[model samples]
Target: MIQHIRISRQLIFVNKILFVFSLFGLIGAPHTHNIRAKRYFFPLFIAIDGSFTEVKVNEWKGAASNNRNQEEDGSAFIVEILKNLGADLVDSVEYGDDELTQILLSEIKDVWRRIVNNPKSLVNSGETPESLGIYMAKILFIAKDRHCESPDETFINGKCFPISTRERSEHCPENMGLYDDEKNEGFCECLELTKEKAKSELRPIYSNETGVCYRQNTQGPCENGEWFVLKNTYPRCEPVPDGCPTDGRHVFWNPDNSTAKQCWEIWTRGPCDKGQLLHLEQDSTEEPQVYCSYRLAESFFTYSALSFPPCPPGTLSNYVGQCIGCSRGCYGAFIG
Candidate 1:
């Protein structure tokens, strides 16, 4: 009978421990859900008092307040938040109070979407919703405290600028001037003397490594059998490919045609006028023909060999010489 009583006490103690664990689980579950719900409804919980309040999923009333003063104050607060997030809503004056509130809400929703999509950005799991909103605002908008990974890069105007750490005098070699804008931005560029020389004679490509401008198609610093060529605006010594002219006139074969076995002069006006380069034309029926065409800016140098004209204002040229129309509802000029 005594052993039976002891067993009953032991059972009661085990039951009590189980009940305590169940109670703790019930308390912890709500807290976990509350944190998740706050993140999930971050856009809806944007309060005017700079505090985050729990918002029900079904309780999103449209921004339609009877009090004009209260609505304007709320709109102003939202505008301030957006401006702090790097949003330049310069045309806000064009929108009415109701329209502007809707736009601001849309912008807030966009920010919330970004935060929700980026899981790795949630560094602090225990951060309050208000603090998280502020943290995410900095991340999505201004990025003022963003860390630059590159050793040669510096943060400027909420963006990364590839500025050198060398002295101003040593930034560029002789004959190259440092083009510094009113801002603290600068880059090594060829001076007027160098530019005139390049235009009169063969164009010289600037070398970032040696800080010297070397004439194209020449053995400036290259080893024997290799010539200095501008490979995508970068000065590099590359061997002359087979079947290409060794006289430094022809650099690459026509990218449009592999079977044509024809090579073209890249920068220099070979078999063309001073302002033109030799261009290739290949139609489905007609035989391949070559003609003199005006050279475009360095940005279009890769497309120099093609015979197609530049795309129209609202279109862009693809690699295969086809003009693709811009997507519907797109604004601004689309240039190559």
Candidate 2:
């Protein structure tokens, strides 16, 4: 019995040793594989301020400490080398802090050496003492943070503006006025006839109501309103629709003819005076349906000035003041 007990204890000790070795093997395999893979996996480009720039990691050898001139200090030498390699360091002082600058200055020599040897490894491993790869990443993050986060926004004159504003400014000439956002349809427009301009040159007349330019005696692009006519010696959209009353009323026009028009009160008994109120359907494919029904709290109502409700979550208002749904698959939000 004593011999058997001793043999059992020896077997237990051997099992524990085997378990430890197995655990270590499982953990070290991936680490060994990563080290081997990193040798030839350096990034060819770096992203900065929403743009990609080509980077040559092999050229980092020239920035090593041994290559510095005797007259130049470490920081100065590294800065000069980076400038020679096409680094945009002019805005570095504006973006970088003192702590980061001091940290880079103190350990730049070691960091550059690590980068020169294996840039991919230093970047992937998140090395201490802040490798050059890490510094560049931080710089890139700072630069991106300073600009706008929305895709619909554009950086202009050190400020963020809506993309529609930029598009209008760029596409529209000085003689032509900006097209109405709701009816722009990705096209520039001529100036409105109401605005006074030099009469030496004949230009196309723009209509604010129809959002179209009309030539002399031409029909223009009117689909619901009156045809184009020469009014006051200029081709213009005639018989403009009258404005609706401010007390929850909207313009009701005949879709078939458009000449017969009137202002109708919303959410009230009108043509159907039997105790039903007018209701307009939302997201209708056919003509806007205005039917008589009992008013409900869930029904949508609009004022004469056309006040829009707040946009739902994950959606934003566009240049035309219409709520647009955000894309689900993309990383950022954009207005269409």
- Each model's TM-score, in the order given? 0.29, 0.25
Candidate 1 — which residues are off by over 4 angstroms?
1-81, 84-216, 229-269, 272-276, 279-292, 295-336
Q: How would you encode candidate 2's per-residue C-alpha lDDT over 1-336 as one tens digit per residue?
A: 865554343333322222222222321347664453233121211212322212321222222324333213322333333322213222333434343233233233333433344323332233432334345434333434224433334445555444442122454553233322221122244432211111111224444454444332233554444444434433444443465432213435332453465555555565655766666543211222456566553333232212233322222345323433333111221111
* Whole-structure CA lDDT of model 1: 0.38
Query: Candidates' lDDT values, in order?
Result: 0.38, 0.34
- Clash pairs detected, candidate 1: none
Tell me the RMSD of model 2 versus the true structure.
22.7
Instruction: At residue 82, give the lDDT of candidate 2.
Output: 30
lDDT of 1 by residue, 166-199 (tens): 2233555643434322122344443322221222
Clash pairs, candidate 2, are none
